[model samples]
Target: MSGGDEQDGPKHEEEGKREQVTVVVLGDLGHSPRMNYHALSLSREGYEVNLVGYTGSKPQIEVLNDEHITLRYMRPPPNLSSLPRLIAFFVKVLWQAFFLFFTLLTGPCNKALLLQNPPGVPAMPVCWLYCFLTRTRFLVDWHNYGYSILALSLRKSHPLVYIYRMIERTFGRLAHGGLCVTKAMKIDLQQNWGITKVTVLYDRPAERFHPLTLEEKHNFLLKLSSQYPCFSSDSPDKTAFTERYADGRLALCEDRPALLVSSTSWTEDEDFSILFHALQDYENVRHQFPDHYPPLIVVVTGKGPLKVHYTSLVADRQWSHVVLLTPWMTAEDYPKLLASADLGVCLHFSSSGLDLPMKVVDMFGSGLPVAAIYYPALPELVKHNENGLIFKTKEELANLLQDWFRGFPQETEIKETYYDFYKNIDEFRKLQWHSCWTCNALPLFSYGKQKHAKE
Candidate 1:
């Protein structure tokens, strides 16, 4: 063999070997699906991944099964809610910075540190420092601007908000590379945050999310019926989605209650009061025109700060035909629950006005059309009269809800509209999360690792 060929063979082979990348998130590991997808993609691309985060919810099957991925749980900071708001925040951040830095300080992540933003206080600063000291590549995934979210609670001119923005711009410029969820974020990152290496990696559904078959739907609904009796048919022996004939045949029920599911984070950006008022309006229509609107089962999922507040607010209202259910589900059941529903509602009003909601992406993957509250970047995911409907006010949202269920499993223009969305969403389901990450995210990690090895 020639001298150069012989010299490079071992180097190339070693470079392709399973190197390690550490992924950090300041939020719950199970809640941050994007970062988990990053770890999974990194594992498939011949990298050993250490997924470091706080513990709470259960992660999905693929992540739990991947041998190359290791989860490192951080000791959560003690709840200091008794302290003043500002004091509590700073104390929590200090504790996180100390713990997170030590976790990475002794980790096997010699190649790169990939982390999410918007709990930007401790994670961004800590991960950046870890990469800087080790000469490892630093990659930030921009889900949204931390400062813009901060502005939601505090005014834009607040000193803390100003300081946080400066910190982001500083480390943002120091990073070796980065990825963001939206093109608008890409442009803004380059313009304001000094992150020249920003790549727009739009959110896609994971592999497990898809339109469930009738059998799958029937099974899932039956499983769900154990807790929520409404999922059972009037017979009490069959699920709401299925019917059994005396002739020994089983089929999908013709007049099933319409199922709608929404994922809410209960943040300032998601105005749930609108959802509440709209549900009341739908209840009125259902009560007044019982023959037309049929019974409705609306399920809301996810954990958040304002969940208790809204739950109690909606509890006092008694509705004869409409029901609101708030249930906590495991990771495995979440995808199935999305697919089992006839429609999905999204209430995220992006804090930055430049990011799309990941929940909507999940809904599309499940082949359920969405009726999302309007925001600037929402059109990127939800198209009016196309795959989904978008609304700005309570009246419009209520109208959409009533119209979508005006006919009880019968011939109506609204049913045809839903049919068109189903067709369009089937086409939308063609792309999955791993495919997008392979094309957009893998190279950045691999190139940095190889370059580091070569040097």
Candidate 2:
């Protein structure tokens, strides 16, 4: 062969190697923000990413907009409600294993597989087998222990829970590398599961979450008012978020309602009743001290199973001082709404008590002070009296709410502590999602890659 032919052969061989990574989550891609962040960060690092997950709510625009990332959807198996629950669960797992294995088998240039564990019933074993067969690297992103989550509904001593823990512990140790949500989880993995190759990649808000400008907040409120009129004032004229100036410039509405935001899946983990009781106490406080507290527009966003149950309860209430608005919104608008809010509340009780809440991280990123329900691992993220407050009981939360918005827009000596949240959050937001992921997560994913392969 001529010199040109020799050169062409080496180039062709080089091009044949696949340096790409497939990031998998068995849940809704849109709702799984951490995996989505991993995909985006990998893309930014100049690696091709194939994001695999169930098709549900449309993923955020960032994923769709990126050229380097492609979304591969897997349809979840339908549970036959007619069949016994055990038989149906068996059918579902079998289907998931088949689909997941083949999905990875056909993926182009799958140099590594990064999995989100929780629905680890079949995903863990299936992914480990795939990695074993293909000589591909397997990495588990431990959001929480799958068996621990299962134990939430099932008894800890249930036969199935024991089996799940055995399976998770077995394949979990086979992972080439791992990323967990906290140091506590990392230690747990090492001691119990024998998975020592772990990195703590705490959740951070995506760049989309930040404090919105005055004009941006007004515009967002105007758009939101069209759907949820709770955002509009009682008058026919102005929105609850802003008022007009003579020169056509808009300012926040005078005596504007304080916006408090919280989101929930209405699952077994987060007890929404605490928030409900807190609202009741808040109403009594307003009745007792009429003019002292600002009228609160608490917008609880997100669609979930128990939403209707709570909606019915809200309708039965006779709350005058506080208005509760539950609006299901698109992912695109969530951050904007978060950024516009004055305070955020979290009632998430971790099933394992080792993982931190992503909502609190997003709240901090949006520069909103939070009143989070206390948990064992909460202090890792929320520093009491610093960036946010931690409370145990509904009464404590109500008192916190009363103190946070003590004097409306007017500043009070007690509310002066609120400004410190802005400073602390600014320091916190300095380590954005990309930086955090790159620092702790990237190296693990970069493991076992061929240096000779094209990036």
Candidate 3:
């Protein structure tokens, strides 16, 4: 839990009168998109949600203001290097655990502690202890098993890996229930760890990601250019950049350009090199097909360790149509950018091979067709050639892209395909939400309340 200015104080009398109250714990607020979604969802359900997380560069406290919610910010840990850094990390974890213990201890009664994993080694043990001491319900929301992710960097048989796995399994069984992002994860937990009280809560896009009219898209591009000067086509250095629309056969018309958008964090698990190689292949083969126009490939990404290296790689390649933009867009602009795209390419391969990417959800919500790099759990969301296409290798992805460009080039066909895909996506979204909230979340919280009542 992160420390910050406390908002509304706990209502001792009123809280006791109510069935139950939840204190949602998150470790990495800077990048925990799923935690943010859970906070918002819990708040919307009229539950008193106490969000405890780090409030680093992007302060989320202001946006989360509600009568039923309270925000608590934690100080970000120091980014020191080597042995001293490792020591500092452990010390910070202990310090955070100390503060979080009291926060949960002194808060409202009939309590349920909802915690996100990954930082699980430190947080889960503390939360489990707190729940045990206070007779409170403990639930772990599994985005990816922390130990599996750590195994990506360290040896699977390493002592630390074994320790993390021990912590996960030990405290995980103590949890009343758990929520996972994918069904595969849920099955794994039950089969391997005997943690059967878990539910699959698939990620969903925010309401902002939806279809936009042609005029709306044009205005959005204008606004986007204004907000990020680098994106402006009128800039002298950006003269080669052109805005064109598709004529219906995947060919660019006189004033039309096929927009391809991909958002990434540029991390190791993503394998962006695959996308780059596929793009290279597309560029090499594009000219052979005279009827189609080259797509203006837009890559929207956040700054990361590999960003500079990848940017250099892209620049050295000198692909004529590729544009790499790193400007962080406002919440309002991100969906608009997705909506304006003719297609979306997702490169996220789960570090743990269990976690699913939320980027695809956003793309599907925007009614955009997707060409997602395939992983084990990805097939659960992306149906090959149904809602979207999935590819296993660079060559396969390039071939898929070429096929898409060759197959759909007319406006009427594009509209029909777009709507057909959108309808399927719309239905899937509805079903997912219903299952996540009504089937998964409601029961978990209700179980806590029911247990509290019995006690």
Residues 1-455, candidate 1: write the lDDT tens digits.
Answer: 01111221332336566677899898899889999889877876667789999998766667887777888988899989899999998999899999999999877856888889977887888998889889889988989889899999999999989988888888888888889988888888878766789888988898788888876877788888888988876675478777667775668777788888998888767888888998999888888888898788999997789999998877788777787899987767889999988778899998889989999999898888899999787787788998999999989999998888788666443566677888888878887777888788877877864578899
Clashing pairs in 1: none
Task: Report lDDT (CA) for all predictions.
Answer: 0.83, 0.84, 0.70
- Score every model by TM-score: 0.92, 0.92, 0.85
> Residue 192, candidate 3: how far off, in angstroms?
0.4
**lDDT tens per residue, model 2, 1-455:** 01121221322135554258899998889889999889878876656789999998877777888766788988788858998978887898899999988888888857789999987989999999988988888999999888888888888999889999998899888899889999999999999789999999989888888899888887788888888777877644368878756677777765777889999988768888889988888888878887888777889987778888987887799688889988776777889989999889998899888999999998888888889998888999999999999999988987888887777766543466777877999999998787788788877766544343545
- C-alpha displacement of 442 in model 1, angstroms? 1.4
Model 3: how far is 373 from its true place, Å? 1.6
Q: Which pairs of residues collide in model 2?
A: none
